[model samples]
Target chain A: MILCDIGNTYIHFCDTYKIWKNLPDEINKKELSSDVYYISVNSINEKKLLKAHKNSYNIASIVNLDTPYVGLGIDRKAACLGVENGVIIDAGSAITVDVMDAGNHLGGIILPGLAAYTQAYRSISPALEKRINFGMDFDELPLNTQSAISYGAIKSVVLTIKEIVGDKKAYFTGGDGKFLAKFFEKAIYSEMLVFNGMQISIDKALKKHKEQK
Target chain B: MILCDIGNTYIHFCDTYKIWKNLPDEINKKELSSDVYYISVNSINEKKLLKAHKNSYNIASIVNLDTPYVGLGIDRKAACLGVENGVIIDAGSAITVDVMDAGNHLGGIILPGLAAYTQAYRSISPALEKRINFGMDFDELPLNTQSAISYGAIKSVVLTIKEIVGDKKAYFTGGDGKFLAKFFEKAIYSEMLVFNGMQISIDKALKKHKEQK
Candidate 1:
């Protein structure tokens, strides 16, 4: 089976559930001939996916949105899928903590990502450019304006997620997922959550296809 | 008695507890002989205070910063002094929510102001400069990226504050005070909170000065 996950910035195509970034060019050279192809895209950049399959023959296909479920932004959906009853946190360009219970998806909170918050204050106030530090102590009194902004933004998101999730299992994913996982004792990190969800969807689709035949 | 309250942005001097901003220069010039100049500067440009009193010969010597308070931002100190017992929110370039109970003061939360959030995203990604409306509608989604950011940042702060000060009286102040006040159901707006805090400080200082004599 071939799986493709498209995001706001980059596209990932993988044959197996390991790191795709380290894959060799030979993987790209293979003719696309899988029983089922699962594709996910958030941006309008479908051309990248089309180019990859240009040399391949026609095959069964399944497409899905990259959020809230399979093909969804794995950062969010995986958190939702990973925990049957808890909070899913995706801390990347932005920090999103969503709560899911039973089958219903409770709303989540989104804040400026840690680095994004620091970069933001620096850009707007030229005076604060030299003072942006992402990993500084938040509880200590912020020494300058830039530290104040960064520390405040980070703490705001952390505290908000903690408040909503309470004692529930907190699942962390995305770019800074592992980094934020340290803050919460209940947090669990699964790097390929989005990919895993996509794989599950592909398996389900193929099973249904065979059953129909 | 001449009371001068210096804040982070402006200096407000008043003879009584009335509207000082709209007071005529002629009134200040004529009746203010300054037997005792009660001056309070809450992390503001001190030079402006000196310039204002450069020609006031009867200024029995300006006394400042001799209070028992330590390690608090001038704006926060001012806000705490202004409110009786409630959550004092200072919404400016950043938003700080300080809680005061009875005569003692409790610590608060600090985060980026609304404009700072939008400006940060706009600087990093110029494509998000379009104006966007913010509300509780998850179905509509954010058409322009800027609205998505503004909605996220504003909602984060509001929700956090609500969690912090549940069922407590809330008071809003600062540059963006009015804009933020609309988010809370029972929040009271005080445009001159810092100045009022300054007044309280001045009163305490004058009483101390008189007792010392």
Candidate 2:
């Protein structure tokens, strides 16, 4: 089975067993299996990928997330399914935190990621361009303008988690997941959460297919 | 004397007495004071403001910001002068928290303001643009995407304050000063902290001018 998840930046592809992240543009469709399930938040990117793999495999029924939450992306919904009851933080272009207790969706918050926060200011004030550098000490207060921005952007996530997550177990997946997970010892790092979730959805669909047959 | 501060989004202008914010593009150069002090983080905006008022005022020796830290904006310097032994939170397009004590500069951190945080994600993912709205309860976990963003953005400031400030005095200034000041009962809300700081600098400059005379 082949599983694919698309975000604002990159397309994540996975097999039922392993994962291939940030897949190249020229896809080698040879590795893909008979079953495929795909979900995306970027429509144009999704269309392009689907067009490339016109007749690749048997596509499974992708889960519908729009009904429950108007514009909740598949990546988030899938990540939620991957976890039972915990605060899931997707630290991608946007750092999103969703809390689920007893499989009931309590709520989620989406704030700026590191790059997004810096770009937010740099886009408006060109003077601040290239002013700040990342990979700083989140504990200490920064002296210069750029360093100040870096500390603020990075620490805001940790600070937000501390405020909202409280006693809930924290799980993370995304590009910056490892770096962010370093801040907290207990945060469960799930590098392939969305893929694990895809497998679950695909298995359920396949079982239903056999019953229908 | 005319005092002007250029932030990421708005230009705050204040005479020794009255103040004007987000001045119109067509600047009324008449009734202008001879002495003007200016500070800016946006170079282009500052250039335009200076160009418009060319030869209109002596541009009073803009308040000199004497600090070891480089790239520290005069606006921040002025605000520092506006307070004593406290943490200054400037909640503008960027939320900046600076610590000052005993007439010495400790350090500061800059985070994304509410708008900046939202814009960070909204700019990249247009789908997220209209999905989230502001004005949500920060204490409670939000069920919707927009409310989560709203709660995260606003509550982040409050959380940052609690983490960093820690028993220190909290002084807030900028557009969202009053709204954020409500988060803490003891937080001092200043409508024109930058302006007040500019006034102090101007006074010191004038005093030095007198001593030189």
> Quick one: best lDDT, which candidate?
2
Off by over 4 Å in 1: A1-4, A9-17, A20-84, A103-109, A127-147, B1-87, B98-109, B118-155, B159-171, B175-188, B197-213
Candidate 1 clashes between residue pairs 3 or more apart in a chain or in different chains: A65-A71, A66-A71, A66-A72, A66-A73, A67-A72, A67-A73
lDDT of 1 at B105: 67
Model 2 residue B17 lDDT score: 74
What C-alpha RMSD does candidate 1 show over the true interface residues after superposing them?
Answer: 5.7
Q: Model 2, range A114-194, lDDT digits (tens) per residue?
A: 677768768646645654455777666777777877677667778888676777788989988878888776789977887
| Candidate 1 residue-wise lDDT, B39-110, digit = tens | 333322345444445543222132222223344455566668766678888876667777677755655556
Candidate 1 chain A least-lDDT 10 residues: A57-66
The TM-score between candidate 2 and the true structure equals: 0.90
* Leading candidate by TM-score: 2
In CAPRI terms, model 2 is classed as medium
lDDT of 2 at B193: 84
